[model samples]
Target: MKYLYYSLALFILSSFITPNDDADYEKEIKEWHKNRIESLKKENGWLNLAGLFWLEEGRNSFGADIENKIIFPTGKSGNFLGEFILSNGEVFIEAKKGAEIYHENEKVEKLKIFPSEKPILLKHHTLRWFVIKRGNKYAIRLRDLDSPFLKEFHGIETFQIDKKWKLKAKFEPTVGKKIAILDVTGQTSQQDSPGKLIFTVAGKEYALDALAEGDELFIIFGDITNKKETYGAGRFVYAAKPDADGFTSLDFNKAYNPPCAFTPYATCPLPPKQNLLPIAISAGEKNYGNH
Candidate 1:
């Protein structure tokens, strides 16, 4: 009897000492999330994104002119600072003599209005904007050099850290490129997709097809947690480029809400059909209150 009691005690002690992989993964995810929150709150982060103005075809005059030019916001001021000509996949903004352009909050005097390099900056007072190319379209992304949103910005909310949602997914390439249709606002467009991610949880297997966006594989997925614990429409997750063996980490703990969650001006992308999951993924960011 004495020997049996000692054996039982030893078994309990060993169980307590055993490493819990789930716990470790959750800790790592929490740290990554904390760092992300801090980065977004930094100067010049997405929290400062003020406006995304789409340029029309031909020359669109911008500045203080109400009739001829699109008027600048209150903090930004200038006269008929010339026009932003959008044509043939290129944008050229001709600035007047006294007009100043800024990157972030600092003046960029060396940046010419129509540089051969393209995507130059224009600034006045605490207002700064940059010309960028999205496919064949040209648009100006405006940011207030001293926007109040940045000044009063707070961190985003997240679900209680849980390790159960950190999943190891298997990548399965499609026979060829697949077409994915995206519905945003009232518009719908088709996008080319490489493949889908297959993973299992609670004895059930699931798959989510992803679209390429810049360097990351963008995935929009919905689950049972939607509208209750998660965002109603869906959420987004970006996986890094796969390794040589075509393997990548799909950590749902890093899932994040779209920009529309914070600001009404944002036109966010909705989740695709194949990406929706039937399981509850109880992890990642929660609903941001700003909306």
Candidate 2:
């Protein structure tokens, strides 16, 4: 993994210093894009997301039938698979007599789905449903591995991968700072922000707040190309945590679309107001289709 990161770093550095052979540079980028597509096609990928049903404060009937409070994709599950009971912020699943649902790889007739340590994934055939908490609302995220979108997917269109867009940045720590993150659902939440990243492009300096995502720094940034060449909501980029010298890498060439770009079911975070840049970033993935 470190080798791959450094390889791309070298490829990106080539634009500034000595350039590598054209074939080797393109090979790394081609492999990177190939892995991106493979990830989107995986069982847990965004393409298989079929439904995202918000669980109300009551028994929410869910099945393949249209009348259920939560409906699975037509052929993914049985007509009357089960019902999710959400009471006082807790979620429990009660499957029908012969309906199949498994938690922790064991068949379950009735099981507590939420308020646990790890995420409990309930699987039935090629369908999988998991409980997720977003603010005060609880939702069941349903995925079908055999989704048509996964089968019909070709590849996302991208701009010519250029090395110049990969930039080295300086992380400036912010004391007692939090950022307001607004999701596509119009719900705003506050998250801890380490600081802003400052980088220079074409002798112009720009700063953007960096939100810690586990060990990575997640960035939701919008540029002038939005609504014309990229997803209207914006694109997402990630970087490794800062080193001892407060230095991190930002590769705009890897900035890609959010989950909402591919599916309406995703509650993706929109770029913050301050993160919108006036400049046009012509690297990375382009708008695929009107979503």
Candidate 3:
């Protein structure tokens, strides 16, 4: 929602693609935190995630009972809710007899979810589900409107909002550099590395490897606080891409926890080895509940 224009000319994009000047740290951080909380309360946020059942290659039965192949929380749906047929990387859902289910606001006896021709939103009462693809495997991510976490939700704990933590950094592109990243699920993946960010903190030189994420540069880094004060897995930060002169601002105040910090169901990438900094970054969101 802000932009820091460099001497080089390039159209400033949205906050998802841009950074801003340091003159308005209080206002920007306030807006950022408010939006973060709103996003978490949205229908698709991690707070509502109740179940993540991996589908085996075959007919996977689902219901509120534990005996089903995909067991949802009890009382959330009928005992024999439905069946998901996973075959050849495709999944088709067959509702149980007399089941009251709706897809895109229409009654359905069956529906092909994976390779979905259209956006498939399956809902039964307050339960919502969709297919999630991780690597070559498929899993059903279930959201419950009545999740206890969402009900008990307050707000995230954060380090003090300080303007000093926000600093400008030099973005130097490494061209074809990339790094291996591992998620909380132990699945390894790789992302494009546009460059390294060079910045100074407390008179010491520091650098971070950055991943190109759409229009913004994504940073997953760890600090000394990670061992005690911060999330053990690390934290995530985003910055606008470098302009022609190769410069962008790194606002540590905006650094936040990964999805895995909130839920075990999430697959959040761990910070690469090179991004780990020796000094402590005492800004941004702190540890939440025990995940």
Candidate 4:
């Protein structure tokens, strides 16, 4: 009688347990998209990218003048704004007097740009620039806080969220494998691939090369939806690390556009040949305006 009474009490409590799964899932995705927009609007976001000027081995003069080795946009800076001296893989800057260039808020006349150390950020009016090293090459990456792209950005378009797009996946480990990633700048780099994530969609099996990124797996992928609905170069997504049994999920709803979609200055890597899916993936973000 005591066991019967306890069983009756447990069954009565279980009857009250209800979950609004669809509403909860939709709200979760809505919140995720909102955070994505906020990130792109931040000060360090891609929307502010204004220019990418490669530095030569010798003195690279920069200004608004057409003759400059690195030209700033017209009316943005002085005709003889500054000179970046690249010698033996180290970069230094000589700011022209009265050009009003400031480094870390202090007016700079001459300073080692510190490419080996943390890059020294310099400012001219609304423009902020710093040195960046890519393999054996170095360049000045400029950003404008008042960029027109940032001002005009409302938000990105995305397909409606659906639970069916969240797919169960199996991770296949590939020891000592490297994937060649080509960038928009025509540079090809070999990135380390820890493994591949195999999943099924619409009763068809597919696989994507997974690169290690912190605690997540970064994936650059392409599909039939490209050129028509997505960025022509490709898209990027992240999946959590597989559990002990090598199981995870690929949430297509979280797939997003690469930095190149927002600015031409970004050197985003193209999706590898193997990652190009043969079917249309009608989820995640769409192409940005006239990208």
- Among the numbered candidates, top lDDT falls to 4
Give the alpha-carbon lDDT of every model.
Answer: 0.70, 0.88, 0.86, 0.89
How do the residues 141-170 of candidate 2 rate in per-residue lDDT, one tens digit apiece? 988888887877889999898878878999
- The weakest ten consecutive residues by lDDT in model 3 span 1-10
Name the top TM-score candidate.
Answer: 4
**How well is each residue in 202-233 modelled by candidate 1, as lDDT tens digits?**
98888888888898888889888888767777
* Per-candidate RMSD, Å: 3.9, 6.8, 8.0, 4.1
Q: Which regions of candidate 2 deviate over 4 angstroms? A: 1-17, 21-25
What shift in Å separates residue 188 of candidate 2 from its native position after superposition?
0.7
| Every model's TM-score | 0.79, 0.90, 0.89, 0.91
Order the numbered candidates by TM-score, best leading: 4, 2, 3, 1
TM-score, cand. 4: 0.91
- Distance from true location, Cα of 10 in model 3, Å: 35
Q: Mark the 10 consecutive residues where model 4 has the least summed lDDT.
A: 13-22
Candidate 3 C-alpha lDDT tens digits along 82-170: 89999999989999887788887887698898886665779999999989887787888888988887898899988888888888899
Please count the clashing residue pairs in each candidate, in the order shown. Answer: 3, 0, 1, 0
Q: Model 4, residue 40: displacement in angstroms?
A: 1.2
109-170: candidate 4 lDDT, tens digit per residue:
99888554566789999899998887788899999988988999989999888888888999
lDDT of 3: 0.86
